[model samples]
Target chain A: MVNVLIDGLKERISNAIKINQSIGIILPASNYPDLVQALFERINSTPEEAWVYVTVTKPCDNILSQFEFLKDSKNIKFVDCISRAAGINKANDNCIFVESPTMLEKIGLEIINIFKEVDENVKKYLVIDSLTNLIIYNDPDIVTEFFYHIINRTRTKNIHTISLAIEEEELDKYLTRLIYLNDKILKVRDSFI
Target chain B: MPITELSKNELCDTGIEELDVMLGGGIPTGSTVLVVGSSGSGKTTLCMQYLINGAKKGERGVFFTITEPLFKLTKNMEGFEFYDKKLIESGMVNLIDLRIISERLGLDTEKYTVEDASALLDILRDIADELNVKRLVIDSITALCYRLQTPEMIRDFIFKLGSSLAAMKCTTLLTSEVPPRKFQYSQYGIEEFISDGIMFLGDIERKGDLIRTFQLVKMRGAAHSRTKSAMSISTKNGVELAPLLKSRE
Candidate 1:
């Protein structure tokens, strides 16, 4: 599975990128962090291209360290809803730590705000680290509504968005809706189907 | 609702520049304006700013806290530079916890009887009269209504309180809470009818962002913009209003 993911990710993403910019990736719950690193690595982000990472699962520091390419970029920013909510209370320069993951409005505002620093003409990307954790903090309806709103908004702004989600049987409804919301889909594991 | 007949009545400017524009000068003096919103929708901040702004204009403003304590309310206000301590010290702005007033009047009950509600209303009137207050804000009408028990009692209490304060020419703002994304303005469904004006402070989803919104739904005395506008609150500026994004296009 690991070999299949790492090798096929770039080619699969490149093929999909040509057809559609808004893509959803469904990963097995086994090891998405490594899968996430691989996905980010495969994209081969550039300094000129603006990136906004919305992380609900891991700290911004952990996410930064995992992807060494992300470390050197001055253009990349983060919407870290977990750090302060977890009682770390520590602040990062480019990161906007939302009061709680439940404050979806504030998180969306921060994402929109940070992206303001980049020129409108710049190639912008919004990568939601994982929605599986976001669902835990918010109700199902709210979670779905948020993505429905964000994806629609980002499309108008000409921003490429990649939302990562862990495929689980219990959350099949949420996963299915998420897949339908995006223009492209890359399913790493499809046990539910 | 086309209300083309504008108020020739005196205006009590809310001190928010854009809001004043939205309100067509400001709230008509001696009118009871309901500021309704869900939690974190900037209702308290808007109320505090109105009071502070009134104080700046040499109009005595009194804020009665119904749910949160006066200390916590003040502590929250501590960040706002507009909330001056001098206003409190010089007796221009007064922050009174309603519990103390209720206790003093012996009407502090788990659920107020009709007579208790009347007495409480009278007590608030006396406070407004004594202070020579030009602006008044009850931190919430919801919590106060919860103690009123019945809808009839809540209506009676609000109706009396609004008229009495209006008679004193006290431009009042009564904060109200509704669950987020819900259209139910007043929990009792009666405060809207009794109040002279209704200013809804709610959230509107614009691109995954729950933008705080202010809509002057129905102001009986003024011709104002009835559309929902985006709102933001900060320590520097208590409440700032901007035009809302209507759609993605």
Candidate 2:
């Protein structure tokens, strides 16, 4: 079963690279640690540089500590959306909260545009830790629209995206439909062991 | 029997067979059930089964996880039969991680502002609309409670969450972790009262091995098993249930 999922994912990733530079969405519904590791393995296997987005719903361990786990890998870059925005907005570093509608739209668009600039062969991967929380404080319609712009730009740049979401929220449909509209879709369920 | 125009109270199905049998049929379609239990209980697993079963029946499900990262949760649940990666990508079964929401919102003590529960609820509804979600679950309500500074504030939030979910006609489940031996009513008592139904999961020590159990403590307008039933976990089913106790008549 694991092989099947991996094969399907490899096929999707390879096909997207071969065909039009397309948008891809991966929905992995596993425990938090396993999901992050699975994504890390996938990113590590890719030959090109990829942008990984991590969105947090609640405060976990420090982001810096989590980032350290990936420090050995040089192909990736970390942009602390929470901290960067805080810096840009001239807010304190301790400020942790959801993005305002205006801020979400702005950052969502910015991330898409960043993916657009990378070389086609770079295999740029955009990871959004979740769409559920992004849309939680805002209107889902607006969030959908926000993703639409990102999706449109990503297709133009030939970048792929993998979005991680918790399966218990019942918000998978929204994220999955976005993936369905793209060239490839990868869904990761829980582990047997 | 192709039927339409089901009332809010008419559309619920607890999604648990035993509980449904206890009730006349199942939870009324479109009713929200609050599954409260301590950590490690089957709250998340139970909710996952509810959504998975709904997906199998062609009723779309959305999973919103606030407690853990999406990838880790998926990896942990990989053993479950319902953990279909395809279903997730195809939008038939969806998972939404709230951690990202918190990050984007930017947690600032200096700029601390009360969260808008209605706004948060709208985001969920938006996702529900896009995915055509008929069933939904928020793994735990602990995150929601922590965000608020006052009990009254949580009460207000619970009230709004209930009304918003009810308006969608989406049968929903919200889980909350409670410590053992605590009151059935939690610090946020409003969630227990406002929610249409409440279920409890607990652990008991017996002969050195920890025994897990689940019971339907309260189901508004429905009847559920009163006896404590043992629960188990396996790689294939993230969570499995076996009757440890039967009605002793």
DockQ values per model: 0.04, 0.01
Report lDDT (CA) for all predictions. Answer: 0.78, 0.60
- lDDT (Cα, tens digit) per residue for candidate 2, span B1-249: 242434544755545555556555777677777887777777887888777777776788889887788988788777676567777777778888865655565544122235655556677788888888889989777676667677777777778777788788678899887777564645566677667777777755532234566666776655456666555543433444444422111
Score chain B of candidate 1 by TM-score.
0.92
Model 1 residue A175 distance off true place after TM-score fit, in angstroms:
29
Per-structure clash totals for the candidates: 0, 65
Residue B40 accuracy (lDDT) in model 2: 74
Task: Please report, as a residue range, the 10-residue window in candidate 1 chain B with the lowest summed lDDT.
Answer: B240-249
TM-score for each candidate, following the candidate numbering: 0.58, 0.50
| Most accurate candidate by DockQ | 1
* lDDT per residue as tens, model 2, A101-146: 2244335434643454566676676666666565553445555665
lDDT of candidate 1 at residue B72, scale 0 to 100: 90
Error of 1 at A81 (Å): 12
Query: What is the alpha-carbon lDDT for the whole of candidate 2?
Result: 0.60
